[model samples]
Structure formats: structure tokens, C-alpha cells
Target: MPRDHSHDPGHHHGHAHSHGPATPHPAQPAPWSILRMTVTARLAAALAVSAGLWVVVLVAMR
Candidate 1:
């Protein structure tokens, strides 16, 4: 007597299973824009502090 493998319940024959559609990823900001914004903010802060210190030195010398 020969045994049959086609009727096995635990057998998988290279069939693909689906898990629904994937969500879209969010858009990213441009690298140059981000870098320019950061540098501009830092430069503004540095200039403000330098001007403040120069004003203080001038007031002290009076």
C-alpha cells in the first residue's frame, strides 16, 4: 500500500499570504533647508550676544 502526501493538512506548497495594503511613509524636509535654518538661528544668537556684550563694555568705560 502507498501513502498519499497531497491530503496532508500541515503542508504548504509555495503559496504567498497577504496582509493588506501598507501605509505610506511621511514626507521629509530638504537637508539644505534644515541646515540653513539651523545656521541662521545660531548666527543670529551669536550676533545678539556679541552686540549685548559690546554695549556693556562701552557703558562700563563711560
Candidate 2:
């Protein structure tokens, strides 16, 4: 049986795409900061959220 993908862009009719990785890797390598906890994006986002909450609380008190 043959998979006819002549009308599609993602899937090929032949098994040509199998020569590459099953999925394309990210364009950019993961940063060293992301590999550590203290400098990770999640920690930065959390700190930003905590600072925003403090600002809201200060405004309410005023």
C-alpha cells in the first residue's frame, strides 16, 4: 500500500523525509541561564509577578 500525499505539504508520498530527524530541533540552543534554577526564565517570570503584586498592594494601601 502507498500513502498518496500529492495534495499535502507536510506529508510526503515517499519516505524521503525520514533521512532527517523525526522532528526539527529548535532554531536556537537552550541558554546556560535556562539550565540553572536561579537564572531560569520561570524564576524571572515569578519574580516579575511577585513585584507586580507588591505594586498593586502598595497602590491599594495609598
Candidate 3:
């Protein structure tokens, strides 16, 4: 008689088992959310300033 190895705890048959839909964490901003927002705002402001300067130079050159 051969022992069945499929049900062995140490065997991994590359099968996925879904517990259920993932549950969302508590409604709270991530620790880095503020830093991300600040960096985004700074980048946007820098781009806006750069565009304004380029427009000024172009208009002056014309």
C-alpha cells in the first residue's frame, strides 16, 4: 500500500486558495501620505515657476 502524499502538510502543489475578498485596513492615511503630498505639491510648483520663467524669456526675445 502506498501512502497518499497530496494531503501532506509539507507538500506544495502550486495551488491557490482564496480565503475571501481582502478586507480594507482602518480609514487612516499612510505614514508617507503627507510626505508624498508635500513632494507632489513642491514638484508642481517648481514646474509652474519654470514655465513662467520660460514664457517671460520667450516673450522678451520676440
Top-scoring candidate (lDDT)? 3
Point out the higher-scoring one by TM-score: 2 or 3.
3
**RMSD (Cα, Å) of candidate 1?**
18.5
- For model 2, the run of ten residues with the poorest summed lDDT: 12-21
Compare candidates 1 and 2 on TM-score and give the better one.
1
Q: Which pairs clash in model 1?
A: none
Kindly list the per-residue Cα lDDT of model 3 for residues 1-62, writing each as its tens digit. Answer: 99999888678768654443375544666676535677778899789999999999999999
Model 2 bad stretches (over 4 Å) = 1-39
Model 1 spans with C-alpha error above 4 angstroms: 1-37
By lDDT rank, best first, the candidates go 3, 1, 2
lDDT of model 3, residue 7? 81
Q: Candidate 3: which stretches are off by over 4 Å? A: 1-37
C-alpha lDDT score of every prediction, in listed order: 0.75, 0.73, 0.76
TM-score per prediction, in order, is 0.40, 0.38, 0.41
Error of 2 at 59 (Å): 0.4
The whole-model C-alpha lDDT of candidate 2 against the native structure comes to 0.73
Structure candidate 2, residue pairs in collision: none
